[model samples]
Structures are given as C-alpha cells and as structure tokens.
Target chain A: MREIQVEYFAALREHAGCGRERLRTAARTPRELFAELSRRHGFPELGPLKVAVNDEFGDWEAPLADGDSVVFIPPVAGG
Target chain B: MKPFAFSAEPLQPASLRRSLADPRCGAFVSFEGWVRNHNDGREVRALEYEAYEQLGLKEGARIVQEAIERFGVDHAACVHRVGALALGDLAVWVGVSSAHRDAAFAACRYIIDEVKHRVPIWKKEHYADGDSGWVNCERCASHAQPPPARQAGR
Candidate 1:
C-alpha cells in the first residue's frame, strides 16, 4: 500500500525520538494514521497531537494521500 | 486566494510591504508587540519563549481567516519572533489593510486578540538572579493582559 511520510519537530520531535518517519497502512484519515503509526513506533505517550496536512491545520478526518506530509503538533506554551 | 500571512520572525514593515498589494486598500493598521521590562513586579531580565511551532502557525492562520470573515479586509498579516529576547525587543506584529479605515482597524484588533488567546505559544520569565518561571496562563486573563515578559533594566 502507498504510505505517507510523517515528520515531528520541536517538542514533538524530542518526544518522538526520531526526526522523520513514514507510515504504511490502510488507514485513510490523519487521526487513524497517526494512531497506527504511534503504535508501530511504540510511542504510547504520544498524546492527542494537532495534525497538520499539506501545510494546513485540520482534523483527523482529513483524508491522506501518498506523500502527504503529516506533522504532529503538541500543545506548547510560548509567548 | 488568502488575505493573510503568518510568520515567527521579527515583524518588519519594509519586508512585509509586498503583502499590501490591493490598490483598494487605503488604510493600513499595524501592531507592534515589544518585550517589556517587567511582569507582576518580577522585573523580568529576559524571556525564553517556546511554541508548538506547527500548531501556532495553524492557529494564527485560523485567526486571520476569522478576521477576514468577520471584517471585510483586503489583507492581514501576523508575524511573531521566536527564540530568546531581552527587554524592549520586538516580539510580535500584526497588520491589516482594507478599503476603509474602519474595517482595517477592527480586523487588526480582532486578529491580535484572537491570536493571543489561541496561539499555542508559551513564555518563561527570567530574573536577574538566575531564576526563571513560565508565565502561567491563569496569571493573566488574556494574551494582551499578560504583563510584558521583559522589563527595562539591566
């Protein structure tokens, strides 16, 4: 199956341990894709992260395509 | 397409002029947020700010969209500075342009207020004594209400 690449940065980067990765799954939406990816990576600590697809803010229900760049954005406290 | 721009760098007017392309816009509203010298009488020496980078951009973009919908504006831009900052440094800026002055003014105000309340950014207040503390959101009711993270002093 076609896979979409996932990237993490800042707080999410440190927490994920790796900078970038890819997920191969039948999951069609961002939320489900992330859930499957986190499980494979053993990142049970990966909390509810805001997902960004193709450089836009959206929810898990957004469909994914091959080569879609998915980012896990954790809640931050910056002024 | 989009009537807004968002960034995490020092807000500079000269660099952002191209965004004001609409000839219909007659009034431009700009907001400059500077690092202050004091917060809650703590006498902030420096400020270490952090952001949920992607989320912040997303939220800021959302705010601009809201402004566009709420007010008929020709353009809107929001820029914020990241990394460490000392007292009196430019921390953020917002600009809005419209055919009339009133629409521009109202949207500019709304953009900043919404960004402050929703943007996923956090700040840590540093004291001259080498102690630092994250400014709690509960301490300040809103983004604009928080005392400046920096204060004027050595």
Candidate 2:
C-alpha cells in the first residue's frame, strides 16, 4: 500500500466534498486508484478525463509511488 | 515577457499588444474570449475559473511555443483570466505577430484551440436559479440542445 495526495477541482471538488486529501490505497495504477476513490466518494460521471501525477500529465496505467500527488482533470472549456 | 500566463486581475489587452510590437512584423492578429450572459439557454450570472497551477503553466507555455513554430509567427502570447468574472468580462486573450497576416491569423486560432483541448483549466458557471454546473462536466450522454427561441408574437 502507498499513501498519496489527491486534488480535485470544479465538479470533482463538489463531489469529493474537499479540495485535497490524503489517502492510503493498494491500487498499483492511477486508473485503479481513481476507480477506488470514485466508488467511495460517489463522484459524478467523468467524461473524457485526464490524469496527472506529480504535476505532470500521466497515463491511466502509470504506477503509483509513495507520497505522489494525483489530479483528475475534466474536459476543459477554456478559450 | 513570458509567452503565456494567467492573471486573476483584469486582462490588459493593450499592454499585451504593445509587448508584441515589432517593426519587422507587418501583421498582428488577436482573439479575445469574453464571458457571455447566457449558455445553452440558461441565464448565466457569473463564472469562476480554476487551474492546476503546476501543470497548467507548463502546458500553456508549450502551446504558445507550438503556435509560434507551427505557424511561423514571430511571436505569440496568451493570457487567461481566473477567479470570478462577470458578464462581458474578458476571459482570455491571444496575440500573435508575424511577417504576414496569414501566419498571424492562423497562429491565433491554433493557440486557443490547443489550449481548450490540452490545458487543465476548468470553468464553473453560476445560473440565475441559484445553481451552477461545470462547463464540460455534469452532463449525460444525452445532451439536449436548448429549445428554439419563441417569436415575439407567438
């Protein structure tokens, strides 16, 4: 198991009920971690989302490390 | 000046244009995105924008660099606003300078499109009914379009 920080924004923040949190998980990949948290927090449906690890864009299946920071990015609407 | 950045205060378009002033460039093109009062037929009251600073900065810079190289523009810069914004406020701005109009115009369009698709910025819009929704979130697979406007006499 590893401990990591998770940050949420926009709709995700609302669903998560907080902006950031620390959690311990046994999930080896980001996809698994997200799925675990989604079930726990009842997060809204994520459409075309992106994941970031340690402040860099990361693949869904990237391995997690202790003390890493993960962010789930939703579809952007910026100009 | 850095090619791209975010400002919480009002965006100064004139200063941005001045920064890109060059005697060699014959064409300068810019695009501005403003906060409109309505979206999908809902009356929008205001908007709040957020970004993951660490990744947003890096990706935003890369997009400007790509625009400059791909469009062969002399220079390109973009500024997006964060925090609360009222109606008609400038949400984002892009300015590109090139030796010719073609490159400048193309680069301007390219930067905005890339930023929208690649950047981590998100927007939450407040509505008149005391509810809000994220721009691209909270949607079902069935996205219903707004009904047509009723004619004045009807």
Candidate 3:
C-alpha cells in the first residue's frame, strides 16, 4: 500500500466536501486512484480533466508513489 | 516580483503597469478582465477564483515569457485575482511594454488568452438566484476530446 496526499479544487472540492486528504490506498496509478476516490466521493464524470503529481502536470497512467501529492484538475475558467 | 502571480486583495493595475515601465519602450498595452453582472443569461452576483498555485504560477510565468519572446516585448506581467470578487472588480490584468505598439498590443493579448487556456485557475460564479457553479466546466465536458479508441484487441 502507498500513502498519498490528494487535493481537490472547485467542483471536485465541492463534491468531495473537503479540499485535502491523506490516506493509504492500493491503487497504483492516478487513473486507478481517481477511480477509487470517485466511488467513495461520487465525483463527477471525468471530462477534460488533468492530473498533477508533485505539483506538476502528470499523466493519468503514471505510477503513484508513497507520499506523492496529487491534484485532479477540473476544467479551468479564468479570465 | 515574479512575472505572473495571484492576488487575494483587489488588484492594483496602476502599479503593475508602472512595473513594466521602460524608457526604451515607447508603447504600453494592458488588458483587464472584470467581473460582470451577467453571463449566459444568468445574473452573476460575484465570482470566486481558485488556483493550483504551484502549477498555476509556473504555467502563468511561462506564458508571459513566451509573450515577451514571441513579440519581442521589453517587459510583461500578469496578475490574476483569487478569493471572492464582486461585480465590476478587476479579476485579471495583463500589461506589456515594447518598442512599438504592435508588439505591446499583441503580447498583451497573448498573455491573457494563454493564461485563460493554460493556467490551472478556476472561477465559480455566484448567481443572483442563490445558485452557483463552476464556470466553463459543463461546456468543457461536452467539448472534451473523446478518449482515444481502445486497441482493437487487448
């Protein structure tokens, strides 16, 4: 099992009901981890979503490691 | 200060513009995106912006740098506001200085457009009807490119 820190923003945050959390999980990739969390949090369907690992944009299939910080980026709308 | 940044308090465009001052540059251009009262027929009362600061700053700065390099601008900067912003408030600002007006204007437009399309910033609209939603999120889903077709055979 790997321990990871996950953060939510905007819509995900609203749906998740929290901004940050750390937990142990068996999921190995961001895609797998997100699937697990989506089941638990009832996350919205993945759209043009992006993921960040260690504060930089990352591939969804990239392997997760212990202590990795992950953030799922939702659609952005900034002027 | 970094070329791109986020401000929680009201943005001071005057100082931001002054920071790009250059004697060699005879022209300056700026763009300010303000919170408007309505969008898509909904009365927006206010807006709250949030960003993944670590990535947003990196991406935002990269965009400004690209503008300078592409347009040969003397200096350029962009500031986006976070937290709650009321109607008519400055939500984002971009400034560019260059030897000619063309470069300055082009670079200013480039920075804002790229920032909107690239940066990891999200805006939530609070509507007059006591409803709120993340702007562009719904449309984004529909417009998203379909997932790559799975291999014909696993």
Candidate 4:
C-alpha cells in the first residue's frame, strides 16, 4: 500500500476540520486517491477540483508515489 | 514562474514590485484587492481564506500560463491571504509583467479574473453583527447560465 499525503483548504478544510492527512491507498492516480479518500470520509465535493503534485499543476490521472504531497483545492474565493 | 506568495497579512506593493523586478521585465501591472467593509449590504467585519496548498499553487500557476498563452506576458504573480483578517486587511493581489504594457495590463486583469472564477479558494465573511457566511467564487457557481437571444423570430 502506497501512502498518500493529503492537504485540504477553505471550505473543505472547514468541513473536514483539519489541514493535512496521511493515509495508505491502493489507488493509482490522484483522482483515484481522492475518490478513495472521499469514499472513506464522505466528501462528495472532492470531484471537479484541480490537483497539484510536488508544487506543480497536475492532472487527476497523475500517478502517485510512496511519498507525494497531494493537495485538493476546490474553487476558492480570492481577489 | 515563481508563485506570488499568498499570506494572511497585509500585502505590500513594494514587496510585490520587488518580486517582479526582473531586468527582462519591461512593463508591470498590478491589481489590489482591498477589504471591503460591506458585502451585499451588510457590514463586514473580516474575512477568512483557506486552500489546499498543492492545488492552489498549481491553479495559480496555470492561470499565469493561460494568460501568457492567451495574451502574451513575460511573467505573472498572484497572491492571496488567508486566515482571520481584519476590516482593512489585504485579501488578494495579482501582478503581471511583460515586454509590452498592453499585454501586461490585459494579462494581469485576465489572471485575476480567472483566479477568482476558477481557483478552489473559499472565503468566510465575518459581519459586524457577529454573523458570518462563506463566500464562494461566484463565477464558479454551477447555476445561472447566460440567456440565449432570439434569432429573428419570424
């Protein structure tokens, strides 16, 4: 099982009431990883969100490694 | 392609300018987001911002790239503050640079607009009356599409 690092922000952070998490996954890509987390955590809004890997913009299909920093940023309100 | 560091404190024009101080940069344009005391008619006390780090930065960079692709620019930086903010705190800021003023100005505007409409950042508005509500990106709202025009009904 590969370990996935997760970070949440804004409303998702508020809803989850946490900032970061590390979990084990049998998932292959970012989308799959998120889907698994959402399934286990009941966060339906995880979809339609853009993701990033190692500080660069990436697609949901981006493959995961043993220690990758994955962030799920929803549509945020900014200036 | 450096990201304009977003924070929860007041934003400084000098610092932003410093960040864009590249010798190759010929033109610079910036957009300042101030703390509006009112929202939809209520007195706003403060606002809180939060985001997913990797995703937010990636989206911000993508917005910059899109602007460069669409409008042509030398460099772009977009920063947004989060956490509990006061009445007059800086909320968001964007800076764009290019070899020409026209591209810089337009790209800066486009970057800000796209970030507001596209990025996954959320704001919680704290009102003066001790009430608060979350403010989502209006442009991203799934409802209310543009109305179709009549095609010379005959």
Model number with the top lDDT: 3
Q: Write model 3 residue lDDT over B47-88, tens digit each, in one string.
A: 999999998999899999999999999999999999999999
User: Which parts of model 3 are misplaced by more than 4 Å?
Assistant: B139-154
Better of 1 and 3 by TM-score: 3
Give the best candidate by DockQ.
Answer: 3
Q: Quick one: best TM-score, which candidate?
A: 3
Cα lDDT tens digits, model 2, B1-154, are: 7888999999999999999999999999999999999999999999999988788889999999999989899999999999999999999999999999999999999999998888889999999999998898767333222112231100
Compared with the true structure, what per-residue lDDT tens digits does model 4 show for residues B8-103? Answer: 667777887787777887889998888889998889988877655445676777788888888878778888887777777777888887888999
For candidate 3, the lDDT comes to: 0.86
Q: Which candidate, 1 or 2, has the higher TM-score?
A: 2
Please report, as a residue range, the 10-residue window in candidate 2 chain B with the lowest summed lDDT: B145-154
Docking class of 3: acceptable
| Candidate that beats the other on lDDT, 1 or 3, i.e. the better one | 3
TM-scores, all models, native as reference:
0.60, 0.91, 0.92, 0.68
- Model 4 chain A: weakest 10-residue lDDT segment is A39-48
Chain B TM-score of candidate number 1? 0.80
Q: What level of docking quality does candidate 2 show? A: acceptable
Clash list (residue pairs), candidate 2: none
lDDT of every model, 2 decimals: 0.66, 0.85, 0.86, 0.71
Per-candidate Cα RMSD to the true structure, in Å, reads: 9.8, 8.5, 3.7, 7.8
- TM-score of chain A, cand. 4: 0.86
Model 3 achieves a DockQ score of 0.42
Off by over 4 Å in 1: A1-79, B1-9, B137-154
Pairs in steric clash, model 4:
A9-B51, A10-B50, A74-B120, A75-B120, A75-B121, A76-B119, A76-B120, A76-B121, A76-B122, A77-B121
